[model samples]
Target: MGNFLCSSSVGRKLIMSLSGCFLVLFLIFHMSMNIAAIFSEDAYNMICAFLGANWYALVATVILAGGVIVHLVYAVLLTLQNRKARGAQRYAVTVKEEGVAWSSKNMLLIGFIVVLGLLLHLYNFWYHMQLQELLGNHTNDFGYSPADGVSLIRDLFAQPVFCVIYLVWFAAIWFHLTHGVWSMFQSVGFANATWYPRLKLISNIMATIIFLGFAVVVVVFYIKSICPACCVA
Candidate 1:
């Protein structure tokens, strides 16, 4: 098993698929949590407080980070192997119009965009919240308590530019996940002709649900802030 994971292409792809699936589930949970902030700041803050500076959350974070690292490293290795295998013949292949051709070809680009967005998000939220809690600062930009996730999100989205940027990032994430969710299954050999369409449909539904959950939070908060009397009671 260890040798297969370290040396086999199929094993590496399996690991990627497993990690990718776990991350997708995490994204769904995260988006749901963020969406709660739009409806009630206190609820969000409670969640932040619950998750903050805790040993369990820290352990989960470390495991998630390790999964990301392993997935990315294997992805690079797979790409390199693919490139070497296609050497001198890589560009000579005819463009084939197969199902999901476009997404398969652009997976790496989508992955890159997702990674970039995650970095920006970590800086904006995680660094301010969990990291600050771990560091014992416990105060955020709006002078609200670090556990006051409502204030953090509201203040961030109140800025027009940041809201727009966040929306854009969400859009990228939507696209990435739309492709990634199905592709992960495909990599694991579940995307046969009989199941391909169903898999794609499921992937699209999951992606849309996650995207709208996060997007609604940002859009609703931005609108509420702009028209406080109409929104805030």
Candidate 2:
């Protein structure tokens, strides 16, 4: 079954679409969770504790990792196949904007940047917090409890360099989603002309909401770090 599913162009796209949808669901939950931090530290930490090293959280993490790996692998495979089919014409393109967005043309490059951002995020939070708990360490390397993720986020974003990097990461995500969301719909047979523009609009809305939600946490925490006297949490 696995061989049959991955041995054809349509199967490859179907796999990508399914994995992309799963990831989109995860992103929505994650974006909502980040926004919770702006409302209350204790509330956010409660969520962190709930998702910490538990059986369910572990399961979810593994599933999320699988989705990421499969999506990235299939994307690379499909791009290589397309390039092979296009031959020299792949590089012989003359004047883009014939129709597709630039993001569609450079999705692989954008995906690479997104992966870099993910690594930075995992280093900052996952390793320090979840990995510590999984390893049975009561306190993280930062000398804080594994459950003290709020402080981790605050400290990471306090650094101007990390803050700027995260914002740039968010920008890349925005571009990727604007193209990806609509394309996924089209891939799965929603390519009817009447719904095309509407899907594009929906894609943009989703991308903006996700970017703003995640960005708010980073920007807010960074501001509070610089001026604890006045800024709200």
Top candidate when judged by TM-score against the true structure: 2
RMSD of each: 2.0, 1.5
Which candidate gets the maximum lDDT versus the true structure?
Answer: 2
Compute each candidate's TM-score over C-alphas: 0.91, 0.95
Residue lDDT tens for model 2, 32-140 = 9988888899999999999999999999999999999999999898899988887864554588757779998998899999999999899999999889999999999
Cα-based lDDT for every prediction = 0.80, 0.90
lDDT of 1 by residue, 1-233 (tens): 58886688787888889888988888888888887776677788889898888999899899889877887777778888888887855565576676545656776776777678779888888888888888888586556676777777777888999888877877777777777788799878887888878888898899889888988888888887898866652
Give the lDDT of residue 233 in candidate 1: 25
Question: lDDT value for candidate 1?
Answer: 0.80
Error of 1 at 121 (Å): 0.9
lDDT of 1 at 37: 79
